[model samples]
Target: MNDETAYKVLTGTEFAALEAGRFEGAPVDLADGYIHLSTAAQLTGTVDRHFSGQNGLVVVTVDLAALGEAVRWEISRGGQKFPHLYGRLRMAAVTAHAPLARAADGSVELP
Candidate 1:
């Protein structure tokens, strides 16, 4: 199945409920018995220069550390391995925001 068909769109409330332990760590009710979240590197680049013309000039810089962490997360899930749910739980608490994305088919894309 395609990625879109492989996952479900988790509502904000549902996600919050999952975070609040309402689902008991199995928030996503998938037909496969388990759900997986993964990330992939879409693009990476350095801010070589900012445009300056009739409009205005802007400063540009790259956040290497943030990019690095994103790369690491992408790499960690590249193999489609089920991440440690406990770790993800802790990460959610630390970040205070869920890193959720919607696929073309409207399903929630994990990671």
Candidate 2:
């Protein structure tokens, strides 16, 4: 993938797991065999569609380069390519994280 970074939206519980050092995967990701992540352009849609009405949400910045071959670009969600990690999401691959924030235009503000 050309993009060097992607974002993961996590619940409070998931964030806690990640903060502890590593995240094996979310339930969906566990079943799917990969961790789901979105590009900056796809962030708002991901939140609106899958995470609506949720509280205590966190946005995590993942370094795709750090993930290396574990990260794959796959076609998903309206035919756009998304980043998926076939391995655990470790803190070493995370660049930053913060509570989810949106601008007046409704786009997510990256931490």
Give the candidate number with the greatest lDDT: 2
Best by TM-score: 2
- The runs of at least 3 residues in candidate 1 whose Cα sits more than 4 Å from the true structure, single-residue gaps closed, are 1-9, 24-29, 40-111
TM-score for each model: 0.29, 0.95
lDDT (Cα, tens digit) per residue for candidate 2, span 46-110: 99998898989999999999989998899999999999999889988889999999899988888
Clash pairs (backbone) in predicted model 2: none
The sequence of per-residue lDDT tens digits that candidate 1 reaches over residues 1-111 is 121111112345545655576533234424323333322221111011111121221111122222222212222323533222222222223222334434696443333
Worst 10 residues of 2 by lDDT: 19-28
TM-score of 1: 0.29
